[model samples]
Target: MRIVLATTLAVAFAVPAVAAAPARPARLGLCAACHGETGMAQIPGAPNLAGQQLDYLREALRQYRDGRRNVPLMRAAIGPVSEADLDALARWYSAQMPQTQGTP
Candidate 1:
């Protein structure tokens, strides 16, 4: 009886640690829709976000969030993001390799 109870308790604790693992932020998927998996923007007119300055990315998102920036799409896109998520995303993108426009 004691061994059975101990085993059950151990399994109960272990189950939650495996099941309740935190998921990656949702904004990362949103960013990937336009910006490639590597942070390089594949679509024309979309600026490459990879290797951008952290301050620049943060300020850009802030402007969109604050209604200072006039881009409706960007405003809607950034509307629900928390400041911490924005900073983390900015740091991630800024660390990627920058894409060059022309061939040598």
Candidate 2:
């Protein structure tokens, strides 16, 4: 009984502390200009990226970087980014909780 109680207490205390500090990509500010800090789109035509699949985000970033996607703004924004930075951006955006309602 004591062991179970102690284990539960440890997890309860530890989890919130870890969750409270959100990990973000270094270039999140750049994305946040169009995509909000929480991954919601701030600009009129920008798409929301929160809760997107990890694979899709990575692939999309790659396509944008490589100019296959063909949006000039996206190409410019992503062109100079390294592979590791792209992956980190993808992971960060994918991990965000998406909005529930249809419109922002």
lDDT string, candidate 2, 39-82, tens digits: 89998989999989989999999999988899999998877899
Model 1: residue 71 alpha-carbon error in angstroms: 0.4
Best by TM-score: 2
> Candidate 2 at residue 79, lDDT?
70
Residue 30 error for model 1, in Å? 0.8
Model 2 misplaced regions, further than 4 Å: 1-22, 101-104
> Clash totals for all models, in order?
0, 0
TM-score of model 2 vs. true structure: 0.78
For residues 50-71, what per-residue lDDT tens digits would candidate 1 score against the true structure? 7888799888888888889989
Using all chains and alpha carbons, the TM-scores for the candidates as numbered come to 0.67, 0.78
